[model samples]
Target: MTRPNRPVSTVRLAGRPTQRSALRRATQIAMALSGFLLWVAWHRGLMRCDTHRAADRFAEVLQRLGTTFVKLGQHLSLRADILAPDAQEALASLQANVAPFPPEQAVQEVEAALGRPWQQVFARFDMHALAAASIAQIHRAALPDGTEVVVKIRRPGAAEQAETDMRILRRIVLVMQGLVPSLRRWGLAAIVDEVAANFRYEMDLSREAASVRRFADAWRGSADIVIPDVVDGLCTPTVMVQQFSHGAHLHGLPSSTAVAAAGKLVDSYVAQIFRDGFFHGDPHPGNVFVMDDGRICLHDFGIVGRVDGNMRRALVAFALAFVEQDAEWVVDAWLDLGLLGDGTDRAVFVPVVRALVADCAQRPLKDWSLSGALAQLVAAGRTQEVRLPRDLLVLTRTLLLLEGTVRLLAPEFSIIEAISRHTTTGVFDEPKSAASQRLPYELGNAAHALPSLLARRLHSVLRQGDLLQLSIKPDARMLSGIDRLGRRVALALVTLGLYIASSLLMQHGVGPRWGDMPVLALLGYALAIRFTFSIARSRG
Candidate 1:
């Protein structure tokens, strides 16, 4: 997703002192710590939020932490399997309720981004903001052509503040890792990097406009969903203008109506992810609205995802493996996606995956908890030395979010069942026979990849044919062992020489009896080092 460079209204921040920012961060940390301490102090007492029906309190705390933390909470909210349902629902509210900047700042942002007066750009623009969030705020405007639209204005220094908060978050993650080694397998660092990368893209409004156009074009004829038309001339890096949308927020919609709408939405989103390999990465309820006619209008194309052909195939394989109850195939799919550790023992991993699948199958997905699944999966992965990739975790979050949103409409809907029905009907699978008939569809996808693949192949051919090549004659492994042994022997010899020199100097009364223990200690150390190395060498 892209953001605009110009904001509707600008509030030039007086270069706030570094101390001010530090103080703000310190204050946030102190508040967070205070909350944690209060929770701990009453964790087993009557006032514990976890024990009481007080999910709202936890959500309130997360929102108070500001953008980065709110985003993290939104991510956590996706894990319906792990978090209590009440808490997840509360956190979902943050998708739209996070703090907003002033409308004057938004107008200034639009003016600065467009490099012209707001009046010159839009025939009539409302100064009041329609909505505000951590990243940007929305305003209503009318174009010279008499078309009504909404403009999204990126907040001033939003990107810089997000980056700062992310750095602080990294430290928090590092501390968490130290306290919990199992976190290493989660690839939290990579997750943070991905979130940062996507958020950076979101900070650019132009990119969001382009992505919105892309989605609009891709789903042009789709009746179940709507992607707003981008107001090309009115868009900038700091601001984006799109066709005005009208719909009831998801929470306000009837459950049955929401379910039907959500089902189609899920189907469309899954198709985009699995079949088209391009997906809107963020699908929070706030980014989605249900029109009066039952069409789902997706907003904020700030975070999209793309999977390569190979990864798409692996995903298909994973689904197939799930259907077939093939543990080996599941493991293979995991490996295909680079979700396994180098030292992982296949023997142990295969059965673990099989057991996990069986356990998962025994329960309906609607009842699944992300945290519980992770705990089980992580426990198994550690025992089997499997390491799940960060992206897969995000993918898991994506699915959970989709499922949660779907449940908001239809509480009893079964994701696995839906997937099975689709797969079995060949809705997701394109048969070879169909490929022959649908050559255009196949070619369209191929055309996207052919250029890069051809270039890579040609470059590889040229490199092998003419590029300089150097060959080494030494046996690399053998040479490495020899080098290591030589270093150890040389160090031992030097130590002996030093010990002798020190002893002589002491004998000549140039030094005290410090030479006695020092020389003996050096010799003993050398002998111990040699003994340990020999033992390891012998074992090998």
Candidate 2:
């Protein structure tokens, strides 16, 4: 699934900012943000846009400002909890509805990117962009051979504008750090970093071209899925040419063939993740189209995901464990994926996951989803101050969107049933119960009897001089414990030393008095206070 970027007319890569220009831009950003915040407070409540009018107002301003501001709005639209539904809707419109650049400028961009005249490269090219977005615009064009294709041109100055905007954002984050004091810990900084990466990635058309070819290869010879063929000869760092594919949005409404279409999409995505290990990161309806021939057309390869063998296996184990209601296995799989943070309590985490899975599994497959379950797991992990890998967050969001998209199209679709399509594909060995796989299998009665006989003989044969070797890597929990203990011990030793020095100085009266106290004693007490304060700060 793919969501288009913010709409823009022109995006030239900008030049370095002079001090005066930087100051002017900084002033503009401050004034705009302050006005927006003040307007929000008057029109809505704190931290949320409660009414449609407020949502519309905030959205209108961001859209008018354009570029990075609009991009930020697009991201905010996904945060339903912080914004009211109407607000989310209002911001989402910016994704595809922002103002388009002049048609002549779009043509110039294409010509410059290709390093050739427009007529030479395209037999017939549409002057008007098919679509305009924050980073780039798409135009319908035909190659010299008359093959139908879509050309994506990077918006002039888009890169420079984004860079300038991110610098301003970091300044805002720094300001927040002083006020809220835990904004970084809240992961807002991480979110901004991802946004920066996301925008940069989308701007690189050559990267997107490569991903298109990769997806095409992954589904080579497949009839159920369509990946547009990239015209690499015409592709450039700022421009991409690829085959055009069409399909219905197929969201919130599904035709009679929807069940089959939804099933195929789900099956293909599961393979992309668990089997092929490369997937589309954003799977919204806008990124996917249903061909008239019942084949699904996947689009927007700017943000594809790749999973190595170990991660793929771990994800499979996690999904199966969830379906099987195996809490321990779920914890283990999360541990394998590095989703759980340090000091995660297995006892508490196991029960929480089991309860959540049990409640979710109570619903029929048609009404069930892993999204809520995953959200709960993530929230629980956060309580322990566990730091999860950022990539896991992206993957979870992608899968959650995919699940919703599939269900929206076909309400009765079953993900499990769809996964069976590749049961024979050998992405995984035949699945078995975790318990059975973890333990040696029981064979015959002779095998069962041999274990007890061997135990008695081994005990008898064990002697004082017998050699037994065992080696195990250190546990994470053990290491964390040692680290904390070391810090505390160091603090305690320093505190004791300070106390002794202060007592000795007081007894001996070693230096000039400060009121009734010796200078040496006063210095020792001051050092102790500083040390104690440092220790407290570290713990906090």
Candidate 3:
């Protein structure tokens, strides 16, 4: 099946502004954003202003500022902790609609990326773009063998522009944080750093290609969902070619088809998070399509999220607790997830969460909204100074986007019910019996090693003539401090081990390589760094 080419609005590519230096870029940003910054200072420091109006103006400025700022605004819209409801709503409306660069430029880009004439690669290449966004534009094309594919070309000067924008954004964040001490707690600088990283990832088409391949591998035999296959030997940093997915957008499907598609969508997402731990982060309506064969096709793999084992378990517990209307358990789950801040007032936080649970429980399945409820919970947490993990926030945004698409197809679809079914059906349930069966063997192994461990320790103490002196009074506070120190030491040791192993892997060229380094080595380094920061944060 092939999708018809649609007319896309084209504009002469007025490329990104080239700034000579960071200072020059910073100056330009200041001039562009001075009004909004001053308004924020006055509103926050002096008389309060209407946040809705302020949010509208902020969105307008971001939209006018170009791609990087629009992306930042979209990210900020997901932060329920930092923004008011009205502000979130306003920012959520920010779209990345832009005129497509001329087809000649796209042709030049593809030929350059391929290092060959365009006719050698494609039997037919559409001049008109299939779609255009801030980061890239998609065009319909066909291989020499007549295999239908889509070509995605990165926007000209996007990388340089993003780099410049991010530098200026960091400076702005630093200035804002210094001016308002309270802004430090919100981690504005950290947010900018994260946005910069994600933008860089998106700019690298090879990463998105890898993501699509990974998803396809994960769902290789799935009958209900379809992932487009990437064209091997064609993907590069600025260009990607993939099988063209053919289906009607979700809104265009018939009611029955849409409802079935909705069910498949919910099931696929549940499996992605609970079973696979990796999922498409942005599953908005435009990215979802209902196939003529009643299968669901997911497009756009640029943004995705991963759930670690701990987060998956916490989410399962949270879903079960929410289903049972056990607010205390919900709070416990959040605490277990390490979302509650040190200054969180449990007395107030509990009541707020309890009320939200009560309200959700009272509503009919069709009327209930998992995303809205979660958003409200996040907002409530914000009020009590609770902080949520970025992955959780991303998941919340994913659910919000999924719900909107689902509603268009099946207005009565119950996300809560779908979650409950998945959780209770052993899809996410751990095998308790298997763990119980392994307990005896684990204990026997531990018991067998205990005497050896004890002998070594005892011999060391005896050799040092400290065996008798080892007996000492145990103070509660002292023991607690020692326990904390021991945990930190263990964590530090593990982190060191990971770094060493990763370095060895990199040196030996072990495992699959991404770019210059081994993928596993890269993962090991990332995990090690995360642990290092965790240790630092705990000490602080």
Estimate candidate 3's RMSD in Å: 15.2
Give lDDT tens digits, candidate 2, residues 1-540: 222343442333344666787778777877776787688776577556554466666666676565687887776655432344456667866733445667788788788888889999999898777887767889998888879999988877777777787788778777877777755666667667767877787778898899999899888789899899898688887889999777777864446768878888888888788867789888887887888888988888876777766677788888777767688898788768765345667675787787877776677765656656666666667566665554566576677778877877787787765654455677566335566755665545558799999887678557543437455788999898789879977987998899899999999998899898899898888898888888777772
- Tell me the lDDT of model 1 at 431: 30
Best by TM-score: 3
Could you give candidate 1's per-residue lDDT for residues 1-540 as a string of tens digits? 221121112223222227678568856855684576467558636554454334555656655666666776666555433455566666666643445666667777888888888999889888778987767888899998898899998878777776776776667667778887987866677667766776787788899899899889888878798888898787888899999988888786776886688678878866786776778877767778888888888887776767666677777887777666677887787567655556765565576776777787788665644333333444555554455554565566566667667777677876666666677555467534555868988788899999999999779978788546655688889898888878767666765665566556545645233534554444555665665566456443
lDDT of 3 by residue, 210-321 (tens): 9999999988878899999899999999999999988887766777887789899999998898888899999998888887888889999988988887887888887788
Give the Cα lDDT of each candidate: 0.69, 0.74, 0.83
Off by over 4 Å in 1: 1-17, 27-31, 34-63, 76-100, 169-198, 247-263, 290-295, 340-387, 410-418, 421-540
Model 3 residue runs over 4 Å out of place are 1-24, 40-52, 431-540
From the highest lDDT down, the ranking of the candidates is 3, 2, 1
Model 2: lowest-lDDT 10 consecutive positions = 1-10
Residue 200's C-alpha lDDT in candidate 2? 82
Instruction: Provide the lDDT at 172 for model 1.
Output: 69
Candidate 2 local accuracy as lDDT? 0.74
